[model samples]
Target: MTSTGEGPSATGSSSISANTSQISLADQFARSTEEEIQFALDEIRNENDKLEKETGILTKYLKRVDPKDIQTQIKGLEASPVQQDVVRVHKRRSRSRTGSTERLLKLTTEQKCDIAQREHDELREEINKFKHETEKILDTYRATREEAEIRLAEMKKSSYEFNRDIVLGAKNLRTGRVVAERVTRYFEDKMRSRKALIEKLRLKNSTLKVQKKKLQLQLKQKEEMGEVLHEVDFKQLRIENNQYLEKIDERNQELLKLKHSSGNTLQVLNTYKKKLNNLTMESNRLKLEISQRNELLTKIDKETELVEKEREKAESINANLRRQLQDYIVPEVLDYVQVRADLYELTKTMKTWERKVDIAQMELQKYQKQWLMMREHNRTVNPWATMEQHAAL
Candidate 1:
């Protein structure tokens, strides 16, 4: 129970410390920008300082490692004779424990420090290189952003002026709407100067046009009063009249073509009228045929009904006669012969009725085919009335 309680307490304390450290780191990140480049530089400097102190310690420890002892050991090993591998190993182990262990420990610690220092120097170089690259990127981005902002401002100003001037329009126009914004003094003066020049040019143009007309009138008056027109003027008139004459010729040709087309259109209309009349006559004939066929079918149905009644009567009479013959022996041969004749006649009549029924079925099928043909014709000729006619049927 105590262990569990202590575990929770320890964990809670560690979590609180971690939270505090994280909050501090977040504060550092939030405050420092250039994407925390200065913070990274500070970290790099701290790491480099640590590496320098370690390098200094290593230098001091390296001084304690005697080069003379290492040289003497190397010479001794070289001078030794060839020996068995087990004996050599035993000797080497003994020497390591008694003589070289301390020196080896010092050398290993120095090597570790050197490696650490070299790694730190490389990391520092890479950090500086990355810092320069990031600074270059950020600097270029800021410069470009500032330039773009200036251009945007200029464009916005120009756009405002364009919209204002266009929407304001000219006061001389019919709309009575007023300009929403006042012009600057420079623009106002510039507009006034341009308007004055425009007015002067407009008056000059009007006067020049009037003078030209006056000169033309005088020339015409001179020509009409006393002088003949120049050959150049006659040539100009001839040219203008020739253009109108060509257009008139073209229009006359078009009129002839239109008249021919109208005649063809009339011919086509007459042909269609004659065809429609023929179709109307044929449709009337078909309708008459359909009515006649319907009357014939009605008559056939009535004949069939009469035949059925006659068959029923004959059958009843024959049944009664047979019953009588069977119950009482016939005294007359003539009566039996009459009964047989009556039975033969009934069979014959039944065969006739059956043949009539077969004929009626064939007629019905033929009528259905004719009706279908008529329906198809109606669909082709009088499409709007087909459904109504079919429903009536």
Candidate 2:
């Protein structure tokens, strides 16, 4: 019996081929993924740089549009009550509002970065999803390849057995033909499925390429818009310069008005000076009166001191008399005097209490009379109650 075992060289060659194909596939996937990621990063960085440059340019342009001097002039002009120029104030307010609106419309670097970052995150998530999907597909393909390898091994064994059987005249030619047909049909279906999968991958790749192109175009358009914005900034600056010149002129007119008013102010100052001189004369007279009043107050204070001393002497005499009355008087006499005083106070308090009691009694009698009248009215209104009261009596 002849052995149909595969040679070592043939097995090694097949394994080598399989390893090389797998390495090529892995390398292609890695290169493609890296290129896409690098491309996206480069695009994002370029956009960021452009946005920074534009933001800086805009900020500088806005700074140049109106200087501090112009704003100060406008503020001073607005505050000039002498000129109450409503038109100028309104114009300034409107300009300020417009400038604020323009500033609001201009995106800051941080804001631009936030939008870019959001887009980047979304794109990154999409890339991650695509990578996950690709990995899943690759895993499925790997599993399918393993299954096919196993099936091939089974087929090889079956084919060897079939060939051996044929050589021994055990298997018929019709059976071999049926086995060959089944193998051909299985390979044809596998090829068709693989071709469809490849076509789908190609379609997806083409769509991604188109999307990338669209993104590139959008970036270009954004750069062009930045240029247009710069131009608009220049135009706006020019307009603002003109407005500033107009404001300077208005300020000069206000200065002229102020100069004219300064003359009137000088005349008013002279009148104020004259009044101040009169007030000084009046103040000197008042100062003299104040001095006279101060002298009179000193004299009154001296008299008050003499009166206070006399009052002190009188208080001392009274205090001495009170001490004599307390110490020299007999205890019985003192007690009689104290009792008499207490009796008098008690009688006064009793008289007040009696008056209160009399007023209270009179109020009570009035209330009683009102109650009697109310009861009589009730009895007259309700004759049945009156009859019941009489029956109870």
Candidate 3:
């Protein structure tokens, strides 16, 4: 029996050891998983950094080639006269005078060589410029490709991280669920006790809810009663206010009557004031007319003096005219005709000035009438007058 028990116990011990080993192995695997994820993240960061450095260097190299230099070289090549041909004609006549022979003079060998050398230099510069530009373009394209690759790698790394996080979270959730299940299994007695307590709490909550509902109903009833009371009070207050307002209205009616009477008195006073002002204005106008009459008398005195002088001048002119008539000059008739035409033009100018004055006076009278009508309308609809009535009330 001892041997049999030992054998069974040994088997049990082996099983326990195996289980411990499995747990350790799982722990090691989890640690390795975390380390591998960290390693992957680091590798991605290092790769990204390397790609960025390379891209930066390539971009700098591309920027070093100036496109303006290439354009300037092209322009210089186009402007070079050596690229164009000019023809010159030479004529030679023999001493025998048979005819003229025309020959075209071409550029000399040295000149042609110089032009070719210049052309070669221009072509070389253009070619070199184009080569540099092409290299710059290629460098840019390569840098762009590298940047895109780097970005793609970064996106892949982020995707991997996201997937890893989801996996880790799921694992943690599963572990939590296992732990929770183990705790529930270990505390079955306590769970029953807690269940009873929860049931009691649920019953208590239900009862409390019913009590709260009853309280709410009571509160609603109280609120309704309070609202009814408030309404009754509001109605009573409104009735009282209405009675007071009626009395006030009666007083206001009396006040309005007084105000109307006062307004009538003010209107009468204003009318008397206006009449007094009109009388004063008439007196002032009369004074002004007297002053104007005096000025006119002075003007008349000056005109009399002027007319006297003009008459003397006319008499002298008449004497000269009579003398001229006696001389019997036909040119004198032309002078008399021009004098008559000038007098007619002066008379027409005076008539035009008089017509303009009459038109201006008519326009002024129309404006005055419009202004007076607008004033009367404003007095009837003035907001200030209404405000004053309200204030008095």
Best by TM-score: 1
- What's the lDDT for residue 180 in model 3? 43
Q: List, residue by residue over 1-393, the lDDT tens digit for candidate 2.
A: 001122456556666787999998678667787778678679889988986765554443334334455457667775332112322332343445432122112344464455445456766888999999999999999999999999999789867765564444343476644454555655577679779989999999999999999999988998978744576789999999999999999999999999999999999999999999999999999999999999999999999999999999999999999998888945588899999999999999999999999999999999999999999899889999889989999
Per-residue lDDT of candidate 1, residues 206-264 (tens digit)? 99999999999998899789776778989999999999999999999999999999999
The residue ranges of model 3 lying beyond 4 angstroms of the native Cα positions read: 1-103, 171-393
Local accuracy by lDDT, each model:
0.71, 0.72, 0.69
**Error in Å for residue 274 of model 1:** 1.0
TM-score of 3: 0.20
Greater-TM-score candidate between 1 and 2:
1
Better model by lDDT: candidate 2 vs candidate 3: 2
The segments of candidate 1 whose C-alpha lies over 4 angstroms from its true place after superposition are 1-238, 330-393
Clashing residue pairs, backbone N/CA/C < 3 A, model 2: none
Instruction: Quote each prediction's TM-score.
Output: 0.25, 0.20, 0.20
Q: How many clashes would you count in candidate 3?
A: 0
Off by over 4 Å in 2: 1-104, 169-393
